[model samples]
Target chain A: MKRLSRLALAAALMLALAVPVSAQVSDGVVKIGVLNDMSGVYSDLCGPGSVEAVKMAVEDFGGKVLGKPIEVVSADHQNKADIGANVANKWIDVDKVDVIVDLPNTAVCLAVQKICQDKNRINLISTGASVILTNKNCSPTGFHWTYDNYALGKGTGTAMVKEGGDTWFFLTADYAFGHDLEKSTAEAVTKSGGTVKGSVRHPFPCNDFSSFLLQAQASKAKVIGLANAGGDTINAVKQAAEFGIVQAGQRLAGLLVFISDIHSLGLKTAQGLVVTTGFYWDQNDETRAWSKKWSARMNGRMPTMAQAGCYSATMHYLKAVQAAGSDEAKAVAKKMREIPVNDFFAKNGKVREDGRMVHDMLLAQVKKPEDSKYAWDYYKILRVIPGDEAYKPISETECPYLLEKK
Target chain B: MFELIGIPPQALFGQMLLGLINGAFYAVLSLGLALIFGLLNVINFTHGAQYMLGAYVAWLLLNFLGINYWLALVLAPVVVGAFGILLERLMLRKLYHLDHLYGLLLTFGLALIIEGVFRNLYGISGQSYPVPPVLTGGYNLGFMFLPLYRGWVVFVSLVVCLGTWLVIEKTKLGSYLRAGTENPTLVQAFGINVPRMITLTYGFGVGLAALAGVLAAPIYQVKPTMGADMIIVVFAVVVIGGMGSIMGSVVTGFMLGLLEGLTKVFYPEASNTVIFVVMAVVLLIKPAGLFGKAS
Candidate 1:
């Protein structure tokens, strides 16, 4: 009877060992959720293109991790912070998503980041511009992958001020996004020995820029810096032409612009305009190759810098999952910070302990009519702002994690 | 010291003139919205889309038909207004008895459809419309330069607003319309076609928005989203002005625009929110609005 009991115990132990080995061979699928402004203003940059970018990364990585298929799902957060947070929570709990990607709006990203941290999920933020994500409210579980307001302001404003566009006037959009852009750009202007003659804050989606344009004209500033993006930027540029602000020797600086905005303004109106960004479509052979594939998927719309960031983050996340040998969120996240992220967008880029994937930024100028050779040709490379030079100093950031470590 | 704190007369006068120009657009758009809401009780959320259609129609006229701005300014509204009339007769006329929110929803859907189609075709870029040669250049007013086109906007809008007011208030047709709004069944008994009047009123409101759009084309780019943003602010304007009286909407629009301009001069940070702030204050003091009727 004792011998029979021992045989049964041996059989049970063997069964338990077999079950774990089989589970290790095929555990569970890695689900990643991409939340963004799918149907709103930032749609062109990080909307459908972001989805496509993630799919490309999955495909390029062979679409499997830990012997399980990879799955991607996306939603339009509609640029609302509350909606974004809710979506993030549901994606983590209900869908069992391991990562959330491409949150565009700063406020929405901040809210969604908190949710991801609470749920112990990874968040790869690509489109938001607020410095606060990495400054006051940085999270270990969230990675700020692309450019921010301070980087854009420092790269564009300081460069323009040094280039002899001394006096500045601002036509700012009235929103958190606009306010941050204006504040950072204004700081750069002052630091570079440029004087901000005056500024006018217009309501978002304002149609008639006549009053604002007239105020800018009256300021007599040499450069009329547009601290607005998307439709606001397009309107300000068009009206500046109508009001002849450019003819009066006032240069226009688009602090944050997309390829779509440049295409809308066309070469005639957008000529000689300087802007700063972390990516451009026609930057190099690798960029062109990636853009060519992305264009085929995005209905011929060229990939913006934000779109490129989406690709980099997704590729890095999948690689980390593979490295960790599991789809568990905490394990994958720890692997992410440890691994060096290398791609066409970045060379030897490392995801910092504080969850910032540092990369190079570019300063580009809109080409003149004569410089254009095709339909969507917009910008010419001005200078390659190095990765270290493009972003704000990490020492300057007031993030609690960074402070605690120090 | 006086020159430092107090705006120079030239600058202040120039800004006020600019304010008046902006007010012209506000007045025209608000008047159209009020007219539609007062009679048909439809929020016409697609007002901006219709305005965009007017600009695009003008652009198409100039691009394909070789029509000038002068011709487009006259014919574009008519074309857009006809589109509005058809929309009213076919779709909007069916929703009069349903919840008012449905009308808002339907119009909002129509707006999405129009904007999406435009964005798909033309993309989200701005298309330039040249100023008519006649209105090109600026006139020096000793204090600042006034573009001729801006002055034209203010003058033309004033004429249109007052003309609309006169038509709705002083004429026999206007009286019949007012009677129709009060009791459409009774007006129908008097041998007047109330439904036709309602349809025409919607068409006229759409036409007014289109006209304002045409006026804005040269000053602003003819873009898909031109109207989407403007219409929201106009809604706020409509809410604050209290849709109770036509003239009240006009006065309130101009006053708020001037207030916004003043904020730009002094506290630029609050410029965008000043109109909303005023609306809140007015709502607190009188929930019916500054000029709105009690619901």
Candidate 2:
């Protein structure tokens, strides 16, 4: 009778060890919640498009992982951090979302990152350009999947400076994201032997930039770094052209411009503007194939890098879950960092210990109206910024995840 | 070589010119609001949406019909004005007997619905209207490189604001309109169709708003939310100028614009709020406003 009891115990232990992944999945399903600005200024770039990207990734990943069906849900944070935190809490506590992705606004991203960490759910940051996430407030379960402000600022700052734009004046939005971009770019400018003449902070979402533009024009800086995004960036760039700032011999460097911005400004105005991006849909054959499929889903609108990051991050997270055979946040995060990302959006990109996905960023210039050959052919790739140089160096990361690991 | 508070005279003057240009928008927009409030006694919260529609109509005319700017400048206001007439006839007419809050709420809802429809159809980035061929370049004014398109706005908007103000405060038609608002039942007994006059007045107020919209199309991005950004400030301008004070609205608009510009030169962070600050102070001290008649 004692021997029979021992044999039964051994059988139960072996069975529990064998399929731990399926057993550990909180519920019978793996849920991915896409939390972003669904109905605000960022809606076009990171809202519905991100949700679609994550769904596409799940479909492409065979609809199931570890015998559990993958489900995607989305909500709008309305560009408010408290609202974002509330959504993140409900998603993790009630909905059992294993990962949340595509946080666009900086404050929302910062708020949601802390929530996911406390709840042990992985947070995939696809947008939200602030560098503070990986610097001061990073988490073990958090991974910055796409580009950050530092990478964008450094690449553009270096490129512009090399092209004789050694003096820069920034027209910044008076907000955390804007200041982050300006500080990052300014650091890069000085590092590359350039000088920042001055900077002016304008109200966020300001429609009129003539006040700040005149100040920039007065400074006579060789380049004006627009450290603002969305409508703010569009207005500043438009007014800069109207004021003939470029014609008067100053260059305009849109440090963190998105393709949607170019699409709005059109080539006539956006032409010759230098910018930095993480992914371009027209870069190569693989990108073209993926973008064709993605853009078709987006009603012929090309996917922005933020949307592309959604797909790449979700796919990699699923793969991590599959490899590690558990939906446990730390285990999946570990596997994700262990695997090198080789996909349409990135080639052998790496997620560092500090939770940043270091990939080669593209430095491109807006093609003139006549130079554009096809629909959405907005950029002419001027250079490829290497991953090592584009991303924040590992030595500088203040992420507790890495600091504790070391 | 002269400087004011450490800024070169050139920069200060350049900023001042930009401020004046912004003020032109305020003046025209507030003039429309004043006209409506003075006559109809209805707070036209839809004024900003009307302005946005004006810009969109101009963009459509140029892009679809191949109509030029000068033609769109005339046609857009007329078209948007007719729409306003329909709005006044079908919707606003029924709400006249209700409290002021009802009209405000109704117009506010209408504004949201209009903005939502546009956004749903044309997603947010907004379209760009190029500078007209005639106004492609700019004039170097030593202090600033003033785009001819922008300069034309300053010149034309000022004339329109003054002209509208004159016609309202001077002409025979203006007298009847003012009389109709003062004692509508008595004016009806005088054989004038007060309802038709009120509807037309509301339409005209909306038209003026659209006129400013067309003027702004080239300078600003033609987006759904553009009107939303301007509406609150324009409303503040109306309040500060007194609800129905036409000339007061015009003069106060320009002065506030200049004040905002000066603030930008000295403390740019407070520029967006300067108008509101002035409005608050005026509300606290001179509730009747600078040009308003006290009740």
Candidate 3:
């Protein structure tokens, strides 16, 4: 009886040891969760299009790394922060998602950022526009990819001011993202010798921009800076055209313009509008090729900068995992900073200690209806703002990561 | 010369004009709601989706059938109204003997289904419908540049509201509708076909919303959710104007729109919430609404 008990104890010990070993190996399957605005106003900017972009990146990377398969899962947060947090929590605790990407709204992104930090997972923000994500809210495992408000303001505001749009009036969306965009664009406008006549704040997701447009027209400013994004920007611009704000010689400076907005507005109403972006699908041969593959999967709708950023960020994240030979969030994040992103979307893009991905931003104008040769040929590149010059300086940020590094 | 109450006269007047345009939408929509509620005693929640459908139908007509804006202005309502008639016959007609909430719940579910279908097909970014060539430009009204399309919207909406009022108040058909609202069974006892009148009334009310939708297509983009938010405010206007009266709904819609416009000029932040605020105040003072008969 004693000998039988000893054997049973040994079997139990072996099983206990084997459980962890099997768990470790099974965890090798990397899961990437994309939480974004799937059906809301920002859906067109980054929705199913973004999910398709991420899948294309995975397939392009041969669908496997470290002898383990990579999996992509997505959920619509419905543009609610609490819902987004719940989704992020489920992804982290239940699904063991290694990375989260393509968060669009600033409020949702911030909530997900906190959840990611608590779970110690990697988060790559591809579509969110808040600069605070890299400043006070920066996380060690969080990387702010694509464009931010500072970059947009520097690229579009400075250029517009230089092109004789000095006097400014703003029609801002009343929310965190809109407030941040307006604040940054106004700073840039003031820095470039432009005078801010007056500004009005309108509710987010609002349909009627007529009153706000009238208030802007009353300012009689040379430039009406649209410090909103996605649907709000589109609505404001269309209403401005209806009010003949453009014909009266008042320019509309879109602070955070996306390719999707231009597409929806069409070239006739959206012509002569100067905006900044990190990626234009028709920028070069490589981009065109990648965008073609992306468009094929996206129902022939060309990928927006946010969608392209998803592809670029996913590809880079995978490369970092391969380089580190591990899926641990900290190691993968450290490796992400060590490597330079040379993807088709961004060349020589580097993730900094403050979690800002520095990449070249392009200033482009909507092509006239007469200049069209193809369906998606919408932009005429006016200038290329260097990556280093476009973003905010590291010394100016209050990120704890930078302070700790010093 | 350009200033008014610390704001430019141009800005104030421009905002007022915008308010009037918005008021036109509210007036037409509430007028429909009141018309239906009078006889059916069921608040048609699907009214907004029907409005959105009107816009989409107009767009489809223009894009697929090469229908001009003028023709679509008449045809889209007819199409949407026919759908309304079908809905009344197949579904809404059965719930007349049940609780009023059943009809409300039924229409609410229908609204969700309609909105979801459109959202699934088109997504929510909204498609642009160009202003007709005749209404493309605007007149520099000295204080404000009045876009011809906007002016046309206000004018057409006023005519529609007045025409509806006249038809319901001054004609023989109007007497029948008013009588049907008071006692459907009594009217049916006289061989008036009250059920058919109820269905036609629902269709006409729905037709009014669709007409507003066609008018709004160029002003606001053709979006599935365009009428979703507008409908809520129109409901508030109905509540404030007393849902019992057609003329009351029309007047309250335009007046509230102008109030909201003035709010934007004076305090931009309160423009959105002002309508609800006024509704609360009106409800507290007169529970039955301004034009509603006391029970």
Model 1, span A44-163: residue lDDT tens: 667888999889988888988777888999998999999998888888878888889999989899999988888788899999988888778888888999788888888899899889
Winner by lDDT: 2
Better of 2 and 3 by lDDT: 2
Q: On residues B189-228, what C-alpha lDDT tens digit does candidate 3 reach at each position?
A: 9889888899999999999999999999998878888878
| Alpha-carbon DockQ of candidate 1 | 0.43
Write down the lDDT of every candidate, Cα atoms only: 0.84, 0.91, 0.90
Runs off by more than 4 Å, candidate 1: A1-27, A195-202, A213-220, A329-341, B1-5, B37-45, B59-68, B94-137, B166-194, B221-225, B235-244, B276-295
Number of colliding residue pairs in each model = 2, 1, 0
Output the better candidate (1/2) by TM-score. Answer: 2
- TM-score of the A-chain for all models: 0.92, 0.95, 0.94
lDDT of 1 at B71: 91
Tell me candidate 3's interface RMSD: 1.2
Best by DockQ: 3
Better of 2 and 3 by DockQ: 3
Q: Looking at model 2 chain A, which ten-residue stretch has the lowest summed lDDT?
A: A17-26
By descending DockQ, how would the candidates be arranged?
3, 2, 1
